[model samples]
Target: MSLQKALLLCSKDAGRFILGTRPIPRPGAGQVLVKNIAVALNPADFYIQKLAIFVDEYDFPAVAGCDGAGTIADLGEGVRGWRVGDKILYQSHWNPDTAAFQEHTLVDAVRIAKIPPNVTCEQACTLPLALATAAIGMYADYAQPPGSRSGGAALTEPWAEGGRGKYAGQPTLVIGGSSSVGQLAIQLAKLSGFDPIITTASKHNFDYCRAAGATHCIDYHATAYEQLPAAVAAITDKPLGFVYNAIALSKESQDAAWAILAPNGTLAVTAPPLVGKANDVAEDGKRVAWMSASVHVGPHQDMAKRMYGALTGMIERGDIQPNNVELVHGGLAGIPDALSCLEEGKISGVKLVARIADTP
Candidate 1:
């Protein structure tokens, strides 16, 4: 077995991350081995480490990372149309052999997007986890238990036939528009021909949101979460049909989003739906859907593959753009501190990525 460097979480809750070695994994059936060049840090990495949430969910000493961009090193049996040295960006699951914290990992071929010539490895690395979160929330279809919020918004995906520009002239709201997922939501909304795409962000990120196709930008600092509904109301009278709450970390934001949603509209969130029984449909036809955003997950596979299949062309045509990138020094070792930056709310409007080659 060949060895590779990895960042290890020796235990749950309080384990220090150790720079260690693991075997370079081989691709299995329908999988491909990628030699990772860059990996992006996400908020989940912090929560899992600080809260010990999914530690027992996978084998330890855990290797934690979800977003990666790299070149294919090998192909599994039955895999075609891809070969060694193909530039690809992909999302990985919690499986130790496939996690992104190492130089090499196996991924199902369907989960990857070829990196177009215009996109760099760092920018490509930011797309997997965050983009999936937004795309799955807004577009993926799945069944949910009655009154449960474990599914997607079930809207028409822009990648599907007639999905592009399907919502023309309608208004859409993306809370926390400067967030990684929020940025992608704004782009996807634009791709679907949504008009007057409104989003809330710091005044500083107003242009940032606009670059991603947000037509109207609200400063969250000036307008508090409690005031968000009215702020959105002032932007467009066309019934607000879709609201993607990318920063669904609080009850206040969730409630404000619910208030802005049309009776028949869908409120999609990154966290559990907790805005005043908002997940349950009453006399009103309003709905709330929370994204579990893993492309490898059973419910997300159909839509995930559709999006991934179209991703290369989207990038080439300039329909989708990468989030702002902030480079973190020290490669895999730098990820722990980068995760801390995420936990402290220090990073905004940009994805923090570390080049695997920078590990020292």
Candidate 2:
């Protein structure tokens, strides 16, 4: 086994991170070994560090990271449609060998997507987790039992038969439109034929949001959450049945979104359901779908496979775009500071990324 540099959370009891070494893992069947070039930070990385939420299931010195973009160093037995040296972006799992903080990681080939010529490794790194969060929240099938739903609007996916332009003239809302996931939601909503795609963001990010396909960008700082319903009403008379709240950590945003949703509508949230009960239905027939964005996980797997299959062409054709990148210096060493920035709410629309191979 070969050693690789990794960032380790030494123990569940510790609140700090340290650099360490781990064995470079070989890809299993249907998997690929990627030499990570860029890895993006997310809020979940901060929470996992502070709380040790998933540590109990792991061995000591757990590795934590979820978004990575790199070049294929080797392919597993029986893998197809990819070759060594191909640039790819993928979502990481909970285990150490598959995590993104390491210099090299193994990913299921089916869950990874090729990076188009237009996108850089830093830009592609920002897409996997955020895009998965948005796509799974908006398109996955609705479970038979509402409580068992895998957290999507169950909308017709634009990649499926007759899915493109399926919701023509429909209106949709995306709270926090300038955020990574929110930006993807706006674009995906546009592909589904939604019109009047309204979103909320800081005034400075209005142009950024519009560029991602949002028809209107509401200045969240200027308009209070309680005033959102009337503000949306002023835009269009269409029934508001769909909402993707990318910044659902804010109770006020969640409440505002729920208030604006029409009867029997779905509100997909990135955070756990804070505005409503996960297993319970609301009185007005509105339902909250809590997003669990992992391509390698349960119910979401099939949908993600289809999405990944189409991702290359989507980028090649300009249907999908990567988020702006703010590169962190010092490679893996700079990750802690980036995670802190995320924790302190300092990072806004742009994603923070690090080049793992540049680790010192």
Candidate 3:
């Protein structure tokens, strides 16, 4: 008759979102129970609710949020190398018991990193999904057919042996450099020693992107997407060998990125391919890989393990840094309004974070 209770945000009915109580879930084998301290917002959290994206039935009572940082409440059977009360950061899915919009959730041990001593929970929460998107886009093995638009760029992961500075002197660009995923890509590119890293962002975020290691920042607002090639040309006479299109939210952005990609280079995007059809790259070796960004799924799982295993070291050593955080008030109750800002594109250069305990 004993059960621990947790609070969660979900669609109580059609178009009705509310916070309600559910039994605190127990971790299964290879899973850990996490008491979420902070949860970071993502664009998908808004689109899934407002547009019914990524869900077929428009199901009610489904939770949102894909990233979080928290403490391990308990460990499940056969789980090793982790103990209760260990602070960790991990990604989550949309399921009610696993999502980050709740006070507690279940996490796979293989897909988590211990929160580094130097980072806060809010900072740690901003990383999981964004880091995964960038890392999987760059380092995970590519699709079998090559340029199939379903895998990563297949570059060597920075965590692998001799991976450090492997791309020394290579030039790269990251579109939407101020975006969460873009910032992580810039940082990772720095770790691999990409010289003269170029990126696109508004002028205000130029320094933000630069802090992440971008040597050049093009103001897309002023330059326009069509002129990216010229803008990039002005920054570096070097060939654009690799482009990370972190802002593939629209075809214009994708097209702009596509225009600048060099032959034999790879274009890695956060969403599905638009200008990157397999046939589109058949004649030339210009490649496109749309990332899945899920550490729990097929093809990405092995790399996820390796990446997560090294994540703590990467953070402690300053090889990877968290994104900027903008706290939204009212915690769970406040997410709807906070999401409105994200949906309206009002939020920029910072990740929106909510403290779960602040829920009333």
Candidate 4:
């Protein structure tokens, strides 16, 4: 086996990633070997480094990256879906050997999505994590339901029964509209016919969020949380259809969300709510449903693939546009700077993607 340089987090201490060489892995059965081209930085990357969420304390020298895009260089046995030269993107919350920070990676065939020729690797990398979370939050199952819309147009028999169709057009609210996941949620909600999709962001991001399909964009920083109910009701008139909180939830935000939700309406929160508790259904008579959007969880994998396929189709057809990506100047050497900027919240409203293959 050949060797490749990768970013490794040898310990849980802050600012601890180190570049070290490791044996380049070959694809196993039902896997594909990829030459990683681009990697996107997410907030979870820093959190994982700080908190060591998935790795054991003894599992030092862990690799850490959740999303990436690349081209297949080799295929393993039983991998019938992909070819040696197909461009693909993947999101995984697994061991570092398969993580996206390295020059080469071996990924499960099922977890990969074919990148359309029209889409750039940088663009594809931006969507996997955000889109998967948005799709899972918007639709109950992996399948897009029949009579669903893709680009403001409707689909015929797009899904089976007991799938995503149940949640269509529910006046959903995507809190934090400027965030990557929030932007994707707005697009997904629109695609699912969720009318009057309301979002809260800074005033400057209102136009961008609207372009992403948010019908109403409120500046949460300026507006009081108590006033959200009236603002949401003015447009929706119906109880809040569905709430997808992209930021960490606070008691004030949760209470505001619950107050506006219609009877039996559901709220799907992505990050930990400020209530400092695990995800749970609130018995506030609003039918609140809290779902953690972590990709490591088992239930997310199958739905992620289906959502990827759908988003790829949409991207190919030019329905959903890619988010603004700030390409970090340095290649692999820039990882530390990028991670630091992300930790300090300096890179907002844009994704920080780096070219990993160009590095020595």
* TM-scores, each model vs. reference: 0.97, 0.96, 0.94, 0.87
TM-score result, candidate 2: 0.96
**lDDT tens digits by residue: candidate 2, 42-159:** 8878878988875558886888889999999999999999999999999998688888988999999998999998888999989999989999888876542345745687899999
- Residue 51 lDDT in candidate 3: 59
Give the range where candidate 1 is weakest over 10 consecutive residues by summed lDDT.
Answer: 141-150
**Please, what are the lDDT tens digits per residue for candidate 1 over residues 175-283?**
9899999999999999999999999999889999999999999988889988887887788888888899999989898889888889878889898778644355646
TM-score pick, better of 2 and 3: 2
Cα error, candidate 4, residue 153 (Å): 24
The backbone clash count of each candidate, in order, is 0, 0, 0, 2
After superposition, the stretches of candidate 4 with alpha carbons farther than 4 Å from their true spots are 140-169, 274-281, 292-297, 358-360
**In candidate 4, residue 225 scores what lDDT?**
87
Arrange candidates by TM-score, highest first: which order?
1, 2, 3, 4
lDDT of 4 by residue, 1-360 (tens): 688888888876654778887888888998888898898888777877788776543456777777888899999899896788889988855476677777888888887878888888988888877776665655543212322211111121123244334446667788888889889878777765677789999898899899998989999887888998888877877656567777645778877876776654556566544442322334654433334444435555555555555656778876667678888776666777788898887766888888886565
Using lDDT as the measure, the top candidate is 2
Give the TM-score (vs. native) of candidate 3: 0.94
Question: Which should have the higher TM-score, number 3 or number 4?
Answer: 3
Q: In candidate 1, which residue pairs get closer than 3 Å at backbone N, Cα or C atoms, i.e. clash?
A: none
- What C-alpha lDDT, on a 0 to 100 scale, does residue 168 get in candidate 2? 87
State the RMSD for candidate 3.
Answer: 2.3
Error of 3 at 160 (Å): 0.3
